[model samples]
Target: MTDPPKAWDAELVGKWLERRLAAARHDQAAADRRGYEARDDYDKAAAEEWVCRALQSPDCTREQAALARRIKELIGQDDYRATGIYDDIRFERHVRGHLRKLAKMTKANEGFEKTLRYQ
Candidate 1:
């Protein structure tokens, strides 16, 4: 025979649920951090590869090559302010964006977009 069920402890159940939710939130925060770190590493590696290819490619124009070199130098450095340009920029994204625009205008056939695709 089965034993009779005990009454539910409302206060105890509430405290348990609160702890569970807190743990879930903490886990989510950790996961987000890991995702961000992974993306950063991927971007860095990709930027390095693209810079190398751009520097070596004959199809890359002089201006594009110069921009690529600059981006390569700035990849691991802290963000800086330019004398007459935008203030407080994320170097990688900013320089990368400029290189992309220049490549588009110059109709570069080096497959810049494919090189930086985040898989």
Candidate 2:
């Protein structure tokens, strides 16, 4: 028997990809602007102030998330710095690399190379 009609045309796919690429480029520019804003001297002080204010929150709400929760226990018990932020709030960059590697290994991608071939 003859094959059924295609659900999607190749031309439609090309147009869709072109639009998506254009939108992605626009988003990249906006992201760069945000980075520049963060680097501004005024923004630096604001970031520092936010860190100082959240100093009491364990981890500065920073990288050591689980450990940071214990910070509250130390708040009134002993002499703790009232306004001090840990150097890094979210995490060390290495952790991100590890997470990305794990995700790539575990995530299903029809186009990516997998340990064993499967669609």
Candidate 3:
């Protein structure tokens, strides 16, 4: 016969799920940083424009660009903490933050998109 699962075990399982999600995000974030860091000036600029595409957030505003970047970092940080990956991971908030900041700058300079991917 099988025994019933304990509450602590269930909690442990929940923690494991959170940690897994965070670890995956950390890995993805690291890759994104490397990709951004490896580009030349013009490529980096264009890549920055692509990065803005991730903002797939409707209502994403020029003024909210910097703030949006901040929020994205916070959201990622919360993911790191929740997933217990912050200890072994050195997820630089500035990587994503700066990338998004550039995107925001581009949008602000170019004027808001009327039909962005998110729109």
Clashes of each: 0, 3, 2
Show the lowest summed lDDT stretch of 10 residues, model 2.
Answer: 110-119
Arrange candidates by lDDT, highest first: which order? 1, 3, 2
RMSD of 2: 18.3
Off by over 4 Å in 2: 1-6, 36-119
Model 3, poorest ten-residue lDDT window? 80-89
> What TM-score, to 2 decimals, does candidate 3 have?
0.24
Task: Estimate the TM-score for candidate 1.
Answer: 0.29
Q: Which stretches of candidate 3 lie over 4 Å from their true place?
A: 1-39, 62-97, 100-119
What residue runs in model 1 are displaced by over 4 Å at the alpha carbon? 36-119
Candidate no. 2 TM-score:
0.27
The residue-by-residue lDDT of candidate 2 on 12-110, one tens digit each, is: 323332343344344434444666543333222333233223332333222233223333333323222222212232222222332343233223211
Q: lDDT (CA) for every model shown?
A: 0.40, 0.31, 0.37
Q: Order the candidate numbers by TM-score, best to worst.
A: 1, 2, 3
Per-residue lDDT tens digits of candidate 1, residues 1-119? Answer: 98664443333323332343344344434444677544433343333333334334333223444544544554445553333222223335744653454344334323332322232
Q: Give the deviation of candidate 3 from the true structure as CA RMSD.
A: 18.2
Who wins the TM-score comparison? 1
